[model samples]
Target: MKKETRHRATIIDVAKRAGVSKSTVARVLGGSPNISEEAAERVHAAVSATGYEPNHLAVGMRSGRSGLLGLVIPDIANPFWADVARGAQDQAAKEGMSLLVFSSDWDSAKEAAHLRALRQARVDGAIINPVADNLDGLDRFGMPFVLIGSSAESFPDTSSVGSDIAQGVRLGMDVLLAHGHAQPAFILGPKSKLARARFLRAINQHCIERDIDPASLHTEDSDYTVEGGKEAMSRLLERASKGRHLAVFCANDLMALGAILAVRDAGLRCPEDVSILGFDGIPSGAFSWPALTTIEKDGRKIGSTTVTCLFDEMAGRPEHGRVYIPCRLIERGSLANLLAGNTDRLAAGR
Candidate 1:
C-alpha cells in the first residue's frame, strides 16, 4: 500500500495564488497599515482558497509576544473563583488574547510551580491570587504580573485588584451588632493568609472601638469549605450558652452555609437560634434554606480589573498601585434582628 502524504499550505503559496508579492501577503496577514484594501481582499481570498494557516509560533517568536495570559487561582471548585475566571476570559477575548488558568489548590508550592510554568510558556503577563503571604521570589520571574484577592502586604510593588476585605468584614459585623447581637463570633479562614489576617485584625479593631473586650471575641479557623464551616460552627456551639442571641460572621458564603447547616444539625434554627452572615455573595447562598445575608463582592469585576491592570503593565502603562472594589451588604434570610421580635425582615430576598 502506498503511504498518503499530506500537503501543508504556506504564505508563499497564498502570495502565489493571490497574484501578489510575499511582502504584500505578509502585510495583509499581519494587519499592517501599509496594505491597500484591494491587496487585503486578494490575500484573504487566496487564504481561503489555499487554506493557508499563519505560523503563529514563528510570528510570536519574532515579535517577542505570546499573546497569552495566565490566571493563577487557589480554587476552581468555588463559584466565586469560577466567576472570576469567566470575567478574565471575557476580557482576554475582547483584547484578542488567550487565557490559561491554573488552580494551585491553596498550596504555596503548587502556586510557585504554576508561576514557573507560566513563565516557561512565555505568557505575556499573569494575574495571580496568591496562596501565601510571602511572595519573595515572584519578582524574579521577570514577567509583569498583577495580584488579585491577595493582601497588599504580599506584593507591595505589584499592581493589585481585590475586594475591600476589612471593610466587608466590618459591614457584616456592624449589621449584626445593629440587630442587637452583642457577642458575635467569627468563622475565620487560615490566619496565615493575608486576607484572613486582615479580617481578624478588622474584627479586633471593631471590638476595640466599641469598647467590647477584645479577649471576649470568639474566633475559629476553618478551611473555607462547607464542612470546615460546619465544624467551626459546631465548636462554637459547644461553648455557646442558650438564650443568648448568638451570631456568627463567616469569611465566605460557603462557610456561612455550613454554619447554618451545623446549626440545624444541632437541633436549632437559623436566625432564630443563631444568625449567620457571610461574604463573597455567591449564587448558592441565595438558594440555601435560610438564604445567606452576605457582603457582596463582585468576583467577576475583580477578575476583569486585575486582567486590565496586567495588560496595562504589559503595554507599558503606569502601574495602578492598588484597586479596591467596594462591597455592599445584601440582606437575606440568614441574618435576623433579634431585638425586633419579628423574623419577617429575614425573608429570602436580596
Candidate 2:
C-alpha cells in the first residue's frame, strides 16, 4: 500500500486560513502584543488547524534576538564543570532563554573554534572559561561574554567569576595548622597555573605568620588528576622527613583521592599516619574511604553568577571587574584534630 504524504504547514497557510496578512501572523507568533484580540484568536485557531511550526532561525532574523545563550568550558567531564553547566542551564530557564554548551578540552584552538561557532549561531551572549593567555577570543567576539575559572583572576580588566583561590588556600592552611601540622606537603599543579601561585603565596604567608621558614616547605608538582596526585604523593612520601606527622594538601579533589590511595598503598592509614586535604569538594569526595577534608568551592554559584555578569554586559552595563564566590571548609574524616582540647570543636565542623 502507498502511504499518503502530508504537506507541512507554513505561516502563509495560517494567514490564508485566518483571513489575515502574513505579517500579522508573523507578529502574532513573534509575541508582539500590538495585535488585536480578535485577530490573535483567529490566528491561533488557524495555527491549530494548520499545525504550522515557526522556523526559529527566521524568527530570530526578524526579531533581532535568537533567545539563546552559549557556554564554553575547559572540560565537561569534570564533576565541577558538570555542576557549573547545570547551574547555568537552570538560570537560563529562569530567564526564558535556551543555552548551547561546548567544551574546549583546554585547547586554545578548540576554544577559538567554539567562539567562532557561537558567533555564527548569533547567541545573545556567552559565558566562557578562557584557555588562552590573551583576550583574543573575547576580542573577536562581537557580543558580550564573561570569563570564568582559576585563570580568570589574571584578567582583571574583564568581567569574570570564580572561587576565591587565596581564601581557599588560607582556609586549608588553617585546618592543617589546627591539626598540629606545621611542616606540610603540598601537591600542586603546573607552575604556570595561577592557582598554584595563589596556593603557594597563601602557604608562604601562613608560614611567615607562624615564624616558620618558608624555605623549609615541601611540595610536589602534579597534573591535577588522580594518577598525577598518586605519583606526586608517592615521591613526596619517599622523601618526607621521618618520625613526624604527615599533612598533605592536594590542589584538587581528584588529586587528593589519589593521594589517599598512595598513602594506603604505602601501608599508611589516613588521619592516623597521614592526613590529606583536598580542594573542590566534588561528590566523590564524600564517598571516599576517609571522606575527604576539602575546601568546598561552589561551582553552581560560580556558573549562575557568571551568567548574571553576562546579563549585565548584555544590558549595556560595564562589567570590568571580577566577582568571586567565597570558599568554605569541609572538615571531614581525612583531617584529624591533634589539639587535646579541640576534638569537640573539629567534630562539630564535620
Writing each residue's lDDT as its tens digit, candidate 2 over 147-182 gives: 888777777888999988888988998888877887
Each prediction's RMSD over C-alphas, in Å, is 3.7, 4.1
In candidate 1, where is summed lDDT lowest over 10 consecutive residues? 341-350
Which stretches in model 2 have alpha-carbon errors above 4 Å?
A: 1-22, 36-53, 135-138, 340-350
TM-score of each: 0.89, 0.87
lDDT of each: 0.87, 0.87
Best by TM-score: 1
Angstrom error at residue 289, model 1: 1.1
lDDT of 1 by residue, 1-350 (tens): 99998789999999999999998998888889987888899999999998898876778898999889999998999999999999999999999888999999988889889988998889999988888677676677679988887555577677898898878878888898899877889899986777788888888898889999978889899988999999999999999976565789999989999999999999888887789999999999999988899999999998888888898999899989889998999998988787786654443221
lDDT of 2: 0.87
